[model samples]
Target: MNAIVTMDALTVDTGVRDLRAADHLLHTLAAELALPEDAFGCTHLVRGDRPRVALSLAFPSEPLLRTAQERLTARGYEVTPGVPDPMGRAVLYPGVSSLTGTLTIAELLSRSAIARVTVLGSPGQPAPDTELVTRDHVRPHWHDGELVLTAMPAVGGTLVPFEVPDPTPCCADH
Candidate 1:
């Protein structure tokens, strides 16, 4: 079989009486998915009178998400990818969380969701004060904590926070 992905399953009974159990389940799932410790959750009505809680885990990619989903599915748990907000995509990690979102560095920084950000310099070589900026291809993990880009000698550029603009927009947005 392919490498196993994701972690484990958690369960909670239906109704408000099981809210705490549900909350703890979500929390545990988030942690297992490697979601940041600050991720939050809430309860929502899914069908007439019956309600289920939604847990939000913020992550960086699709493979990570597939892994999480597979794990839950293996344990007989149903998982669904939540709709993305105006941002256009939701977070996906090694495990599916309650709710998720894709965000830019500025947005993440502005929201104060992440504590710090770093730029990886170049694709294979080190350049003092410069970083790689890839414009054509993007990886699922590219948006994680420290964003790295592929650098071209002609561009003489560096990877800036996703929020910043390139002096020369020659590199296309990946």
Candidate 2:
């Protein structure tokens, strides 16, 4: 089961400048869901006639996804039909409500300050919690007004990790 959610007609200030605030809101949503911080991918900019922020969030289980959807809808944002990604894996679109803090993935990871490492994958199977131990190597950079996280490849496969941004800048433009 995959889900895709999109919130349209959200008006921001003229000089809001970037989607960093939006990304931070997504991060907060993930935390609210109790999902691991690394499960979300970096937010990217969708350039075209009208630009928008494109972000990818992952959940290790199904129940978590449902809860997130329900929470998002309750907040009065329009959610798109949930769908799957290119990997046939479920995908859910989280509406940007408001950001409570302003911190980057790097800062969040630092807060976690991983003390160990673990790998949960075998050949032909995607590794689970692959970056738990070496999460410090991951770096987040802002690209096109979105946060881009680059993770270190472990065993030649990519693993999604989570982080908690510190001193998260609040979305005051609301």
Candidate 3:
């Protein structure tokens, strides 16, 4: 993904896949830049060999944006300057820690806008249960099948940022 940092926002031109796969990276970057949890959002861009997703995140100031660009560029990401949309959805940063003990599917829904949960492997496979424990980081993984959500520890409970899988094709969009 190529990142574009400007005075007011951070834009990422993600190749092939949408911003869903890069949620963790975005969250990490936001944390590193000290950006507020609600300062980020994404929009779909039609380009390249696949979907060119643009993730635009707001920074507190121009200096912070420049700092983030420099830091991300130093970390090997392609950084540049570009305009970002101001109408993106607010990104929720579920920290790398749990907020409570065990939780049910109902509880998870109450916490975020997660519509469904399943395991990895096939596209439509279900996890067979709605019970989950917490751990360090809770992130989603995309597979050929359904998107699987997993975390560390596999018990207790953590605050997982709820995200929906992008239905766009990975590459060579058919």
Candidate 1 residue-wise lDDT, 1-174, digit = tens: 101111221221234333345545655666676654333222232444655543333334556556766666675665555521211111222222221243343433344323234444433533343433324222222233322222234243434333222233445675
Q: Model 1 lDDT vs. the true structure?
A: 0.36
| Alpha-carbon RMSD to native, per candidate | 15.0, 12.4, 10.3
Positional deviation of 6 in candidate 2, in angstroms? Answer: 19
Model 2 ranges with Cα > 4 A deviation: 1-17, 81-174
Q: What TM-score goes with each of the models?
A: 0.34, 0.38, 0.43
Q: How close is candidate 1 to the true structure, as a TM-score?
A: 0.34
lDDT per prediction? 0.36, 0.37, 0.47
24 in model 2: Cα distance from truth in Å? 1.7
Clashes of each: 13, 21, 8
Give lDDT tens digits, candidate 3, residues 21-47. 556556666667777543433343456
